[model samples]
Target: MTDVSSPIDTRWFYALVIAGICLNATGLFTPILEPDGALYACIAKTMAQTGDFVNLYAVGRDWLDKPHFPFWVTAVSYLIFGVNTFAYKFPALLFFLGGVIYTYHFVRLSYSWLTAQVASLILLTAFHGVLSNSDVRAEPYLTLLVIGPVYHFYRVFLGARFYHIVLGAFLTGCALMTKGLFVLVPIGAGLVLHWMLTNNWRELLKLRWYVAVVLSFVFTMPEIYCLYKQFDLHPEKVVFDNTNVSGIRFFFWDSQFGRFFNTGPIKGAGDKFFFVHTLLWAFLPWSLPLYIGVGNVVRSIVKRIEVPEYISLGSGLATFLMFSLSGFQLPHYLNIVFPFYAVIAAQFLVRLKPTALRRWTIAQTVIGVLLVVLIVGVLVVVQPARQGIALSLSMLIAVATFVFFRNTTLLSLVGRMVGAMLLLACMLNLFLYPTFMNYEAGLAAARYVNEQPQRAKRITALYGPSTFGESSWSYEFYVDGPTQYVRDDSVLQQLAGQRSVQVFTTNIYADSLQSRGFDVSPVAVFPYFHISQLTGDFLNYKTRTSTLKPYVLVDVRK
Candidate 1:
C-alpha cells in the first residue's frame, strides 16, 4: 500500500543480505541437537553410509514416520561433505536460503521492493528460522517447497509462462513428499480464498488446474514407490506393534488425518492455543507486529476492503488453525508458514505512520536489549567458562551492531528491527546454542568415547532399560558405531566377561552394574538436558542444577 519508494542503495542491501547469510552459516558447524534433530541426522548418516536410500531405518530398525525427500537431500550433502555436522545441516540451510530468495520474489511481485527485502530479512533472522538451520529438520525443506509452489502458482495465475504451472505442481508434489498431503492445505487454501475474494471462481475450474493436480500426483510416485517397497509390500513386518500395516495407507491417512483425530499410533494432547503461544517466541522480535498484522488482515477481509495485492492470509490462518486443532503438534511445524507471516508483517510495517513506526521500533529495540541482557545473565549463571571467548565475541558483536544501527537515519524503522534481529540471531547461533548444546550429554559422551581409541573400538552397549531416549541416537551418531541395548543387568555381566565393552548408561545404572560385581570405570559424566521439554526452570541457572540428570559412560570389564 506504500506507493512511495525508498531510495535504492544496492551496495547496502547486498551487504545486509550477505551479512544475513553469514549469520545463518555460523550455526552450520555447531553440534547437531538431540531427540528429533539427532535422530534425523543419524537417519541421514545411516542412509548415506549404507547407500540404501529407499528403506529408512532408526537404530537399525524399520523407520516409517516421514517420507524420504529430506533424508535424500541430507544424504547427498553427507556424500559430498563427508558426514560432518556441516554436511548434515548443509542441505537444509541451502533450502532455507532458497526459501528466503522465494520469499523476496513473492513479496516483490505482490507488493513493493522495500517490503520484499524486509520480508526476507525478517524470515532470515527469525529465531526459529536460525534454530531450524542448526537443528536440521524437515521444516527447512518444507519451507522452501511450500513457498516455491505457491510462487510459481501465483505466476501462472498472473498469466505468466505455462511451464510455471508445471513447475508449481512439481514443487507441490515435492512438498508433499517432504512432509505429507497436508502440504496442499496452505497453498490450496490461499488460492481458493483469493479466488473467492476476487470472485474469480472460474479460474479454479480451468483445465490447467487439473493438469497441475496430475503433475503433482505424478511427482509423488517416487515417495509412493519407496513407501510401498519399504512397508506396504512387506505387511508381515511389525510397525507400531501392528503387523500388516500399509505404509501407503499411513502416508495418505494415518500421518495426516489420524494425527488430527488422535487415532494414530503417535498421539499427542492437542491445545488449541499451542501455536498461539509458540508464535510468540518462534517469530521473536517480529511477533508483536505479526499479531497486529494478522488482526488487520482479518478485519480487512471481513470489511471487504479492496487491496492491490493478495497476501496468503487464508493459507497462514488455515494452517495455523489446522495445526492447533491437531492432536499431535510441534513448534517447528509453524516454520513453513513463516514466509507468509513475514510478508504480512512487512507489508504492515511499511504502511505504518512514522510515529507508529517509531513506537514499534522502540519496542523492538527494548526487546533486543532484553534478549542481550538475558544472554549475559545466562552466561554468568551457567558459567560456561570454556565458551568464554565465544560469549565475549557474540556480546561484542551484538553491542557493536546495536550502537552502529541505533543512530542510522537511512534505514526505516523496520530496517532497525532487522538489525536487532540479526544481532539476536548472532548471539543465538554463535554463543547461546553452542552453550546450550554443551549439556546435550549424548554428544559429550560420544566425543569422550571417540577420544579413547580402545574404548571407541569396543562394542558399545547402552545398559539399563533402553538405548532409545534423549541421548542414545546422538551418541550413536557421533560415535559412528553400533550401540546394542542391553536390557538385563545379567547381560552386562556376560558382556564384561567376553570382550571390551563401553556402556553408556545413567548414574543409577552405573552404580547398579558396579553392585552386581561388574567393574564400571566412569569415563565421563555429562549433564543431560531434555531439549524438547525445555522450560523456564530448566533454563534458569538456579533451577538448572536441580533439573539436570547425569548421563555416564563407563568402561565395563570383568
Candidate 2:
C-alpha cells in the first residue's frame, strides 16, 4: 500500500475527477422530474416569456415560496437556449460544478493538495450532490453560493485581501436570494465556531465584519427591491391566502423561520432524526466514513487535542444539528453542507492509521460491491428498452474498475468504489431515467400535442372528483400555444365555445364529462405516475400497471 502521506498521481486524480463530473452530468438529457424541476422550469419559462424578472409567477399566479435567484438564472438560460429541459438544467449544473471547484480550493487552503483532490471528488460523487445536479433545484445554487462565500470569508480571516470580503459578501447576498436567510446558519456557524475553537474570537469584533454586513445588504438590494415591488407596494395583493402579506418580510423572515417553526402557510412534519437517517442513504458510499470522521473530530476536541482546523467540522455539524431540529426537513437541504462533509471525511481518510484504514477499506469495498448489485438489480427488474447499452456501460465500468484499481492501496480501493457509484449513476441517468420518463406521461402528451398544428390548439387540463390533482407542469411548459387549468364544467364550456380546445384530463373525469352531455373525443391515452415519488409497486413490472393511472388528452367540443 502507498504511504498515507503521499499524494496520488496527478493523472489518476484528474481521471477520477472527470469521471465524477461525467456521472453528475449524465442526467443532462434525461427528462426533468415532476413536482419541483418541472414546476421551476415552467416558472422560468413564464419569466422568459413575460420578460419580467422581478415577479415570480407559476400557473399565471404570483409565487412566494422561494427567492428569485435560480429563476432569474434559469430565465436567462431559457432566453439563450430556448426553454428546453437542457436549458432549464444547464445553468444549475454549472453552479454545482462551481461548488465542486470551491470545495477543492477550500480544502487545499485548509489542508494539503492531496486532501483537496479527494475532498472535491467526495463532494462531487456524494449521492445527494450527484442527484441535485440532475434534479436541478435551489440546492445547486445554494451549494455554490454558500461555499463560495465561505472560501472567500476564510481567506479574509487569514488576511488575504480586501476583495475577499467583497466577494464573500456578494456570495452571501446570492445565497440569501437562493434559499432565504437560513443559509446564514452554516456560513455563520463555520466562521463563528472556528474562531471560538481556535481562540481567535476577538476577530469577531473587527471593523471588517461590520463592513461585510453592510456590503451583504447592499448586494441583496435587487431581491429586496423586487420583493418590495411585487408585494409590499400592493398590500391588497393576496398571497398564501392572506391579503396583507409582505414579500420583503417573507424573504427575510417568513420564508425561513415560518418553515422552521411550522408556522408557515406551507408546513411539514419534522423528525428530530430525519437528517441522520437521511444521511444514511443520501450521502451513500461515504456516509459511514463521514460519521466516523465527524465523531473523531468531536472526540479530539473533547480530549483537548490540537486539531488542524475546525471550519468544516463547525459548519457541517452545526448546520446538520440545526436542520435536525427544524419543523421542516428535506433530503436535499443537506446538499448545501456536503462540501464541508467532503473536506472533513477526506482529511480523516488521509490521516488514517494502517489498522483503521484496513477496516474502512473492507467496509467500503463491501459497499461498492453492493452498489454494483443494486444497478444490476435495477436493470434486471426494470428491463428497460435500452438494456443492452446500459448493461454494456455497466460492464465497461466494472472492467475499468478491475484494471485500474487492482492493487491493495487505499487510493485504488477508493477508485474501485467510485467506479461502482459511477456505474450506478450511469445506469440511472442513461438507461433507467429515460425509460421511466415514458411513464411520466405528461412529456409524451406534450410531445404529441406539439406535433399537431398550433393554429387552434389551446390546451386545458381538467381536475375533478376522480382525479387527485394529477397535472403536469412539463406538459404546460412544453406544449405550444396557451395552456389553462380549469376545474369547472362551466369554464370548459366557455373555453370550448371560444376556441378549438384540447383538454388533458383523467379517463374517469372525461367519462363523467361525457355523461353530463359535454362533447369529448379521446385523442391519446397516457400512463401516469408521479415519477419522483417512486414506490415498490411501481417498480415491479407485474404490479406497475395497477400502480399507474390513465390520463387522456382529448379534444373537447361544445
Candidate 3:
C-alpha cells in the first residue's frame, strides 16, 4: 500500500487524477449496442426516428422492465452521435465516468487520496464491471449517484457544509427517477443502523433531513407521473391483467419489497450464501483483502467496540444483508456498494502488518492465477477450429508466465504479482478475449445481408434475441432492404411464398421452418453462438454457456 505522504497534498491529487478518465476512454470509442446497448440504443433511435421520448417503444411495442433514464440518455446521444455502436454505448461510459469521479471524491474526502486511488483501481478492474461491461442507463448512472447522499450525509454528520445535503437530496431524487425504490434497503438500512447504533437520536428529527426527502420526491415526479399516466390512468388500453398480470402496484410495492421479504413479483429463492460467494469472483483480487477487513469489523462489532470501524462495517453489513435477503440478486447490485467497502478494505491493506501482507498477497496471487487459468481453459474448449492453433500458442505463453510468477520468494514481489495478474486480466479483455470470443457475429451477419446487391434473400429475420436487438434491427435498417424478425414455420413460407428469401433462426427452431417450405441450408453457423455482449456484459455475464447462434441462411422459399 502506498503511504499517505503525497496523496494528502494537492500535487498527488492533480498529478494522477485523470488516470481513470483515460482508462475509461480507452474502450469508449468502440461498440455501442453493448450490454443491452443495442436495446437501449434502439429506444433512443426509435425516439429519434419517431420523435417521442415519453412513449418508449421497441421493435414496435412498449418496452418495460427498466426505467427511462438510460433510454433518455441514449436518445439524446443518438441525436448528437447519430446512432452507431459508439453512440449506443455512450451513456454507459458517461455513467461509469460518474461512478469513477464520485468514488474518488468520496474516498479522498472520507478516507484519504491514497485510499481513494486504491479503491478507484479496484472499481476499474473488477470482473463484475467487465461483465456488465457498458450500457448507459439508470444502473450505471445510479451506481454513481447512489453514493452522493450517503457520502454527503457522512460529511454533514462530521459537522461540515450544509449545501451538500441539498445536493445529495437532489441527486437522490434523480437516482429514484433512474430506478425507483432501490435505495430503501441499502441507504435506508445503513442510515438507520448508523443512527441507532451511534445513539444519534436528535439527528433523526432534523428539518433538513425531512426536507431532503421531500425534495427528492419533488425532483423525481416526472418519471413517477409518466408511470401513473400510462398504467394507472389508462387501465383499459395500457394496463391488462393477464396471467402475466400488470403488477403496476406490485412493481411499486411487491416487486422490490416482496423480494426483500421474499413475497411479490419475484420469490426469495436466493440463498444467504449468494452474495458472499458472488463477491469472491465478482471483486476478484480485491475480494481477499476486503474479506479480511470486513471480517475484522464483524468481530469488533459483535463485541460492541471500535467506534471508527462502525461506519465502514455497518455499511458492509447493511449492503451484504440487503442482497442476502432479496430474491432477485445480481452481480452489479454489489457494484455501487463495493466502492465504500473498497476503501475500508484498502485501509486494511495500508495498515497491514508485514506478515499479514505477505500471507494476503500470496493467497490473492494463487487465487488470481488459478482463476485466469480456468477462464483460459474454458476459452480453449470453446474456441472455433480456426482459433485452436492460436489458443494453443497463447496458453503455452500463459503457462510460462504462470510458472515465472509462482517463484515468489520475496514478499514485495508477491504483491506485485497480484498487480501483474490484474494487468493480464485487463489485457485479456482488450486483446485476446475480443478476438477468441465475441457475439458480434450477429452484427456481422447483419452487415453481410446489406452488402448483397442481388436481394438473393427475400425474408430477413433474426433467429432469437440477438435478432430482436441490434442484429435484426440492423438487418432491417441497413441489410439491402426491410427485414422482418421471424419466429416460426408459417412466416418462413409467407416470406418465401414463391421467391427464395433467406431466413435465420435458432438451430432447433429452424428445423420446423424447413419442414413447412423450401430449402433450409446451413450458411454460416456461429458455432460459438451467443447473444451480443450488449446484454451479457451487464445482465448475466456469468451465464456464458447459454448463447444463441442461429445457423445463418437456414430458410425455406420457393
Candidate 4:
C-alpha cells in the first residue's frame, strides 16, 4: 500500500474540524422542514407526551411505517430538552459525531491516521451529511449504527477480545431495529468477504460467531415485542388496506424484501441507476474522487493485486448492489453506506501514485473553486440580509483558508475541498433554509394562527382532498392546538354553523368557500412545494414561482 505520510499542520486541521462542527450545529437551529422532519418530530413529541412507546400514532391515527427505535431516542431527547427542533435533532447529531469518531478509528486501524482523518472529514463535510442533520431522519441514526458494529467486528477479526464480538452483535441488533434485517448485508458481507478473500475461512466457523448471532437476536426482541403487542395482538385493526396485517411479518420480510420486490403496500418508482446518479450530488466535491477510488479498488481486486483492507470496498459494493437491484429506493438510503465510501476514498488518497495524486488534487481544486462560485451566485440571488455579516465572514474565512493553502501538497487540496463544502453548508443552514422555510405555508399559517389572541380560541379546520401530504402534516405538527380535518369540499356547509373558525386550504378550494356565503378573509398566501417532490425547478428562484401552487389560510365565520 502506498503511504503519503507527511508532517501535518495541526492548526489548519483543527480549524477545518471546528468549521465542520459549527456547520452541522447551525442546522439544529433551523425549523424542521416538512413532511418527514416535522412528522418525525411530532411523533417523538407524541411518544414523550403520551408515554406510549410501543405503538406509533400520527394525526390521531395508527402509524405503522417505521420501527420505534428512532422515535424512542427522539422522545428521550424531548424529555431532556423539551419539544423543540434542537432537542429533536440533538441526538441524531451526536450519533453523527459518533459515526465520525468511529469512522476515523476504523480507517486508522485498517490504514493510517492520515487516511482516517481524510475519511472522517469526507463523512462530515458531505452535502447529504449536513442535509440529514437538519432534516433529522432515520439515516443519521442508521449511519452511526452501521459503522459501530462494522468497527467492532473488524476489531474482533483482528484478534481482539471476545467482548468485541458481543458489542458488535449488540450494535448489529440496534442497526436492525433502526432499518430492518437488511442492515446485515453491509457489515456481514464485509466481514465474511474479508475472511474469505484472506483465506481465513476458519474465522467464519468460530463459536463466538454463533454467540454473536444469539446476542443479536436477543437485542432485537424489543422491536419484535413492540411489533407483536402493537399489531399482532390487534388483528381487527386495519393497516395498509388489510384487515389484519402481521407486524412481525412486516418487520422481518415485507418492509425490506417487499419493497425490494415492489410487492409492499408502500412502493416507489425505482430506477436501477438511482443511487449511481444520487451520489454525484449527495457526495458533492468528493463524489469524483470517490468514484475514482472505488474504480481502483475494483480493478485491483480483479487483477489479484494486494489490497489494503477489504472491509470498506466489500461492504460498500455489497450495499450499493443491493440498493441498485431493489425495486424501491431513495437518495438518503445511500447515507448509511457513505462511511464505507469515505474510507475507500481516503485509503485511495493515502496510497495514490504521485501522478494520480496530482491529478486528483487538480480535480478537487477545480471543484472547490466552482462550489465557491456557486455559493456566491446563490448569495447574490437570495441576498440573505438577515445573516449578511455571518455569511460574509464565513465566505471570507473560506477564501482566506484556500489562499493560504494554495500550492500545497495533496492534503491541503483535500482541505480546500472540505472547506468549500463547509462554507456552502454553513450558508445553506444559516441563510437559505431559514428564508426558504417562510414559504412552508403550513408551518407559517400555524404560527400566524397562534399569534392571534382571538384566533387561538377559534376552532381550526384543515380542508383538503387528502390527509397525506406535506401541507397537512406540517400544519398538523406546527399548529398549537387541536386541528380538525374536513376532507370534502361538499362538507363546507357543515362548518358554517361554527361561530368562530379558521380554515387552511389551497387557492383551488378558497373560491368554493367564498362562493358559499361564508365570510372568508385570506390571512396568508404561500407558494407550496411538496417536500417529497422537490425537483431542481422547484428549488430554483427563477423557476420556483412557476412550479408552485398557492396555499392559502383564511378566517371563516358563519
What local distance difference test score does each model get?
0.81, 0.84, 0.59, 0.81
- Specify the highest-TM-score model's number: 2
Quote the positional error of residue 250 for candidate 1 in Å: 0.8
Off by over 4 Å in 2: 1-4, 454-457, 461-470
Encode model 3's per-residue lDDT on 469-524: one tens digit a residue: 53445344334444566654566567677766666555665675556555776665
Question: Please, what are the lDDT tens digits per residue for candidate 1 over residues 190-271?
Answer: 8778888888889988998889889999999999999999998998999998999999999999999999999998898999
In model 4, what are the clashing residue pairs, if there are any? none
- Per-residue lDDT, model 3, residue 36, is 53
Please report the TM-score between candidate 4 and the true structure. Answer: 0.93
lDDT of 2 at 71: 93
lDDT of 4 at 281: 92
Give lDDT: candidate 4, residue 240.
83
TM-scores vs. true structure, each candidate: 0.93, 0.96, 0.78, 0.93
In model 2, what is the error at residue 477, expressed in angstroms?
Answer: 1.5
Winning candidate number (lDDT): 2
lDDT tens digits by residue: candidate 2, 72-120 = 9999999999989899889998998999999988887768787887788
Between candidates 2 and 4, name the one with more favorable lDDT: 2
lDDT of 1: 0.81
